[model samples]
Target: MRLNRRLFLGNGAAAATTLAAPALLAEGGGKPRVIVIGGGAGGATAARYIAKDSKGAIDVTLIEPSRAYYTCFFSNLYIGGFREMDDLGHTYGALAANHGINVVHDWAIGVDRDAKAVSLADGASLSYDKLILSPGIDFVDGAVEGWSLSAQNAMPHAFKGGSQTELLKAQIASMPEGGIFAMVAPPNPFRCPPGPYERISMVAHSLKQTNPTAKIIVADPKAKFSKMALFQEGWLEHYPGMIDWIGEDFGGANVSVDPDAMTITIDGETTKVNVCNVIPAQKAGHIAEMAGVTGGNWAPINAEDMSSKADPDIHVLGDAADQGDMPKSGFAANSQAKVCANAVRGALTGSRVFPPKFTNTCWSLIDTDDGVKVGATYEVRDGRIAKVDGFISAPGESADLRRATFEESEGWYAGIVADMFS
Candidate 1:
């Protein structure tokens, strides 16, 4: 905005090339157009930051499929009965009402990179000077044997929030006494490294109170998982004899499921389960791939700015971003969003850009008032977001510390929702 021509040359593109894009790519006086896709931890935060900081100097449009976003971060707690579904749902009304962001509720079906536009499910195309995609994740085709989207009703993934979470909770509540609950854990490089284990703990917490005799069987493709020792210790202390974890050593990866029969086969042994929660291998949402930004499963990004490695004018955030060492967590997504927001604002408005510093803490509830966490502070190192310092809850932390940890997660939930929407 400092110079008349600067608006057209956002991202320092040459004037000739910038004009080759869609006609909506702001000219001399037109405000730069920023289109953000998705409205969760990453996209919502990105849109809010860009809109608030730009202060009407930039046109920010947020496209999301849902009016009320359900966070996947605390969905496990919902399954554990610690929170109701309503507690996790947040509306975009606040974003539009307060920030002047054009919040459009629609699904992004495709992207026209040459034209610098996004195609919507409703047949509308939005032209963008800069595109921010944080569409979360999608399951890999046939990642789990005999498990597919059509079978989700019977074997609910419940990986994403909302109705699937509710369905999983209802299925758990309807589980007969002494019934077996099986979890088909995903392989490496999936969303939320500690998520499935936390869910197991939460499910155990629920079954202990309602059906103590119920058993949980976790079939994990990986040999070990995040905070394995801490979760195992907590399981022994709180819900002893409730969880049986079968890792790769025990053919846990050699699994298949029959949704109709409600049976899971692990290493040629088929067991009937009252509820089957399948967490399949994950990749960036299809829109990212459709945009030709994804390297493989995830969209690779520059650690310094969260800009796409493929396209400097495009950014990827949240679970979709391959930012090296950071795990796929709500906290990590929000951190990356701020860095991307700063970089994008600087590109479009010629604002002062700050050095990027990112931190992420993944907290999981082991039981009531019993929480454990693993976290790290990251910086640009070796051309990727690499850990500089970190911390994790120990195997035998004090009950007081664990309780405090649970309270901390609650506080974080409130702060993050406000950070994203309010």
Candidate 2:
């Protein structure tokens, strides 16, 4: 659950030695050391796969602040009362003991690309022959007026899946019978394109059971979203009276919020709500930007290998990388991590790294038994992320298929967690 002094010092020394002697391979012992920052979907997978496939030829050290991770992919189920925190929470001991990944429970504060090292908040530095960063997104200050990290204690986003989630869950639990719960959906190119709507659906489902008179409002910046028609159909058929979705045309769009007032304005009209969940537009993790790995909102990587354009020795995946045509979802992050792992291995071992095919599937539950999905397969071509042939979801499918897909989503989550920390 935590990194010991021996492991930390050993990892740091291994990283330095590996970088210092790039061409040397010790007889029967020495292997290239890889230091990965952030043990979420992308970083965890990269650490596991590289350790598995490379045998003892690669040493992987994963740095993350938390020992357990709660996935956003299934946290909406928690809101729907279909699951619990323990059901979704995953630990890193298996990654350390079984997969040979040295897990560091610490935060990375600075990245020195020139020295090929990462500085920790604890005044230690981790050197790396190759660094993989999948720190995910950070909320942009001032993007939403009057809402910052401190104010999040009162108005929880629950987007990152930690204490914020618990706070939001408690707020929902203690709401008055007829109270209004409002959610402000972020703009495009954010993590999980269909996440906000799916969250609303789950919240409304819960409200229907606990407080029949409670109202759920969604103030969305976008006119349309992923699986728009299907979500609307499900809401109308299931929780029609409980949900109200306001689009841009109806003065529902806003770029900012007033946290102190607990009010949000759109088109010169301010509305107050008992609970507010505001998801701000996102960009690559701060470390990536510090290392000059990103453009405006995301890092540009060579899609063939998920190698950073700024520095080939470092690979950036997940929501941080600008994978064209790929929606920023946990599925995408997991898929890209495997591709990056293989590439990292090949880069270190002098093996042939082939062009990889990537895939993503995002499933959203509208209610307990009803769900919708979107998926695509992709391949790198001409240095860009491109969708491959035969990549589509079965829309307007049979009820049996939808139910089966929901079940399959659960399986996929388990498989992905295995592919990462298991």
Candidate 3:
């Protein structure tokens, strides 16, 4: 029953079943309880694996406010008209009915570490042997001047990828034929580093077809960005003379917006725009802060187990955890969730705990059938998740290769969501 990193990496599903069957596979005599907060990729995957693998021996409860969860991943594609809203939404019915999970639609207001209990907004409490928090990201208040949650409708961040995404798409579609679309990109260490730029690509794609005369401008605070050369090349090739990207060196660092005026000022130069998308700086979701697990803006965790450094009984996942080398993407989150699920099940059931191994790949669509990706495999080293090997799409890949890559991403989206929700 001794499990190692290779077993976890090469045969994860089989390894998880083996570890979970040792002490927990049958119901009846006072089972171990696990409560998971949030229902995103990380939370859903962890909850499902732990519950399904352990059979009825683990009483699993998933506390999520939304009944239908829409993914933030590939949300840019929705703006690009590659996907529909209904196509991105998922339900908790399967986790409840098929997997025997207690899916509660409620807010987790507080976590009492010493008591090992979570207080819900509905005036009820649930105690647990282990608590999993995958609360996602929340914007830092006043991170972007003149833009707050109140102004989200006027200038959508669309980072959450639900109604906000839909609103942004509608706004872009409704712009005047020759209108100017401006974006205020977030600073570094935000959720999905390449997100805003990919969004810009999608917006440009839609406008290029319908309103060929329209323009796009980005005011970014970072001097450089993820996949900068690749995205720049794509912009030049697919939508030439359509996008203007201003980096920090070119006064992109100095930016502010007036939602009411539909304007953005960069380095004392103000320009009026017909549509604005302002994505602000971010931090871990507030519930993690409430749980006292956050260090600065994110929660710290043990790379071996994804357990909160602040509390052994609590684990943090996804964008909320400050695990080095892993980007805050849904793919990374799902990968970490599987590793965490294995460790948690092992700890609870006296099963063999495996050395943690993880992987993530982030894909972006430049245009129709044009795709690019960057990815890496990781292992625990020096008490942090360190990248072992990596690869990225080159600047001048063939059209057929790029199209094949895009097809690969589409298949991945279908696979990961099914791995998480179904």
| Deviating ranges (above 4 Å) for candidate 3 | 1-11, 20-29
- Expressed as tens digits, the lDDT of each residue in 1-422 for candidate 2 is 12233432232222222221133352345777899998889999889878866765788899999878888778888888988888888989998898788899988988898988889989999778899999898877766666788888777888887678778878888889899888878878899998998898888888888987998878787888898888988888789788888887787665456778877776677777788888877889898888788888889999988889889988999999987878889889877887788778777876445557687878899887786788888888888788875333344667877777787777777767766776
Q: What TM-score does candidate 3 reach? A: 0.95
Off by over 4 Å in 2: 1-29, 389-397
lDDT string for model 3 (397-421, tens) is 9999988888778777877777778
lDDT of each: 0.88, 0.80, 0.88
Q: Weakest 10 consecutive residues, lDDT, candidate 2?
A: 12-21
In model 1, the Cα lDDT at residue 116 comes to 91
lDDT of 3 at 104: 96
- Go through the candidates in order and give the C-alpha RMSD of each one to the true structure: 7.3, 6.9, 3.9
For candidate 2, give the lDDT. 0.80
TM-score to native of every candidate shown: 0.93, 0.91, 0.95
Clashes per candidate (backbone, < 3 Å): 0, 0, 0
* lDDT of model 2 at position 179: 92
